[model samples]
Target chain A: TQLLEQSPQFLSIQEGENLTVYCNSSSVFSSLQWYRQEPGEGPVLLVTVVTGGEVKKLKRLTFQFGDARKDSSLHITAAQTGDTGLYLCAGALLENAGNMLTFGGGTRLMVKP
Target chain B: DVKVTQSSRYLVKRTGEKVFLECVQDMDHENMFWYRQDPGLGLRLIYFSYDVKMKEKGDIPEGYSVSREKKERFSLILESASTNQTSMYLCASSFGGLHSPLHFGNGTRLTVT
Candidate 1:
């Protein structure tokens, strides 16, 4: 079975700090997606990277897909209180399967003022 | 914006009771999914449908069943609710494609006692 492992299960940082969350997997994926989920709400898609070594930016967040399509990363620049939420990474194995996604354990971020 | 709507935000049920969770997507998406999220377990897909009346079991679908009678609506059913079934249930929809991002609802927090 394919599994995605996420690093730094929990993070607490002060405002204006920079942080990076990593998602790694042994199985290659056709695409990877990042999402941010706030308390009492479902996850919201942040970015989707389909190419190896691809990078996508959304305001203060930067998402990078691994060269082998087996990993991905999310970097937050100058994180603020509004950035406090759960970050999740999901891998889509579209080569041999449908558009189903396998998700990683989320990283909870707490940005304090 | 794509909108996915779940019928309930919270639900409480007794063991052995039958439960139903409803979801509707306004984007005319061809794919609908049901997932359960728990602390430290992230999100596990329970069932998915690629089109109307087409359902497939996901990673964890042992105690769960799904129905997609229409293109815009999907339902998740728990044949016999148990304590272990207590978790946050999320419904999502996506336009069928290789790299399409999923649009999610606010989720239903179900508690089986």
Candidate 2:
């Protein structure tokens, strides 16, 4: 079974603080996706990294996929109060598991002013 | 833009009562999934339908059943509500393919008391 584990289940930081959330797994994946969800809203896809050792940037957010495709990380720089939300990482396996994602426990971020 | 809509934003039911959760998608997606989101469990797929009248059991399909009568709508049924089932339920849709992205609904918070 493939399992994706996220570290620091909860994070609280002041405005302008930098933080990083990690997602680790022992099994290799074909692709990884990052999502941000706010209160009472569904998760919005931030980015999808398919290749190992891939890094994708979305403004103040940076996402990295492990070289072995077994892990991933999300980094936020100069985070604002608006950045507070639940961050989730999902992994997609190759084969019949196509389009199916296995999600992580998620990191709940709280940025206070 | 793809839009997934859940019939209810919140639902409260008594234990032993049957519950039905409905979802609809504006996009003609071939794959529709029902997932239960718990704080530590993340998003566990209960069931998924790839085509009309075709459904597959996911990793955690126990105590849950689903029906897909049409391509645009999917319904999840809980034979008997339980306190343990109180959580955010999410509906997502995506093209039935190898690497297509998924679109999600805002989610319905179901409380079983």
lDDT of 1 by residue, A1-113 (tens): 33999988999999999999999998999999999999999899999999999999999999999999999999999999999999999999756568898899999999999
Q: Across residues B1-84, which tens digit of lDDT does each residue of candidate 2 receive?
A: 999999999999999999999999988999999999988777889999999999999998989999999999999999999999
lDDT, residue A25, candidate 2: 90
**What TM-score, over all chains together, does every model reach?**
0.97, 0.97
The residue pairs in collision within model 2 are none
- Clash number for model 2? 0
**Candidate 2 residue-wise lDDT at B78:** 96
Interface RMSD of each: 0.6, 1.1
DockQ of each: 0.87, 0.78
Instruction: Supply fnat for every model shown.
Output: 0.80, 0.71
- Tens-place lDDT per residue, model 2, A1-113, is 32999887999999999999999998888999998999999998999999999999999999999999999999999999999999999999654455789999999999999
Candidate 2, RMSD to the unseen true structure: 1.3
DockQ score for model 1: 0.87
